[model samples]
Target: MIVENKEFHSRICVDALENAKSVFSPLSSEEKQLLLEQMIAHEFKKGEVIYRVGEKPDGVLYLVHGKAKIAKAGIGGREQIVRMAGVHSFIGYRALFAEEESYASATTLEETFLVQLPFETVVSVIRSNSDFALALLKSFATDLRFAENRTVTLTQKHIRGRLAESLLLLHKEYGVGDDEQTLQVLLSREDVAKFSNMTPSNAIRTLSAFAQEGVIALEGRAIKILNIDELERISRLG
Candidate 1:
């Protein structure tokens, strides 16, 4: 996916440090305003590519609305989702720091709103603002921590466990449905496979098996949990 630097003009800008509070601690108003000046809001349509693998790294992109996935192509051009990103999170810095091209890709899972900060501009601000720099560091640490957990789940878990963990993650990131049992996100089977670290066919088969076991109830793209507690137990066991 490509991230184009489109100009935006707004009467006011967000308090960048407050927006970064998810990773950075609180900041002073002066610092927030200073950092905000370096940001530009960008809108992305659903299914649009944000950045492609091997593309030059440009900057730190933040999610203001909607969601996205950090992914990489696996064997045969299949994709594997490494992370799910939403409001207040940062994306597209893996290559920027190394001064190399991106190793993975990022794309909007839905119509998304983002704040794109040029890498050099942000680093310049960070150089002067201790809070901003620390926040950026914390963001990096958060990504790393999630990566470590994902490595364990994808590498060690059984198929059921992997699926369960993926669903749980979806529930956390996307939320439950009106029925309070169904996952809210409408992910394609391929996306599910990518997120679950399984082949598309395997994800389909296991989900079907779960249906047979009365672990879940499916309605086209909507999946309602029939026995979430048991699913959790199975995931834990795996």
Candidate 2:
């Protein structure tokens, strides 16, 4: 959506600016406002590529709204989705900080809104603020830890264990419904498969197995947990 002349400093812009601080903390009040002055929100359509692998890094991008998936194409042209991001998530910082090409492709899994920070200002902020530099280090370190856990899940776990863990992660990321059962975000079988490191056929089969075993209840895109305790047991056992 285009910014209206009357609402240039709209609440959304102010909110996004505050959030920018969480990602780039070295920004002083004056500096943040200055960077905010340069920011313009961009909307993305569903299934659009925000950036592709091997492209030179330019700016830091944050999801102001919606979801994105980072994926890589493997041997035989199979695409493996590595991560899913939601509103307020940090992305594209690795390549920007490293001053290299992006290692993975980022695409909109749903319609998205983003706030892009100019590269020149990013470098300046990092240089001027020690706390901001530490914030970046902690942020990247947290991401690395999550990535490491995901690697173990994909490489070591059995199919059932992986799916159970994937569902738990999704629930943790989104939340359980008021019933304390259904996953908050609806997903296609293929997307679920990608997150669980399985094929679509395997995802479907395992979901069915879970349903029959009273591990979960599935109705179309909605999944409700029948026995979260058992699910946790499976995740732990894996």
Candidate 3:
């Protein structure tokens, strides 16, 4: 269930922290309590902006539920999706540790629940805990690597390859429905284009092409992969 109040938020936070079994696992009970005390839960509807470019980092925002996309506005107000954050993910943190304004904006892809860890408390915990600091550093490095790879993909991959890769990425992030074919997440064509670095018209045309070729089956906002092998091949070739 979605966390609605501070008490429930605290419980969910504890559960997420425990399940992380990384940084939070090593935290002492007192430390955990301290973090829980500092945390504040906020809910957002689909398409709501959580944070925007040039906004100063207030705290570390954790995705307690639902999904969000991190993107940066490019020429002509076109948005280039940097990454998609799923449940149990952290968003808008790169700017927090860097001590700078956010370079990207985070927006909810669906109704989302967020837990904000006050920046002061985060700094204090990291100062007191070397393990947590190290974990966060590792996470930052991993994100940098992903950004580097995405740069290569978006710049070099063909349109078909880019769209194929995006579908695969969405599948990995959100999984599939009960039928094990249709994707779990529902996204507008515009959002899909932003993720794939294409215009909405192009995205629509290519998706139609894929559908005609039987590479995928499209039903409104739903996309079902009918030929995973071919999709992977297209991604590989590009």
Best by TM-score: 3
Task: Report the Cα lDDT for residue 16, model 3.
Answer: 56
Over the stretch 1-238, how does candidate 3's per-residue lDDT look in tens digits? 3356767677767765777633467677888889888777787899899999999988888777789999999988878988988887788887887899999999898998877888889889889999888887777787788889989999999999999999998988888988988998898999999999998999999999999999999999999998889999989988
Error at 4, model 3, angstroms: 6.5
User: Superposing every Cα of model 2 onto the true structure, what RMSD results?
Assistant: 2.5
Clashing pairs for model 2 are: none
TM-score of 2: 0.88
Tens-place lDDT per residue, model 2, 5-83, is: 5364355556665764456545689877767777766677888898899998667787777788888888897888888
Candidate 3 residue pairs in backbone clash: none
The superposed Cα distance between candidate 2 and the true structure at residue 110, in angstroms, equals: 2.2
Q: Lowest-scoring 10 consecutive residues by lDDT in candidate 3?
A: 15-24
| RMSD of candidate 1 to true structure, Å | 3.3
Arrange candidates, best TM-score first: 3, 2, 1
Worst 10 residues of 2 by lDDT: 1-10
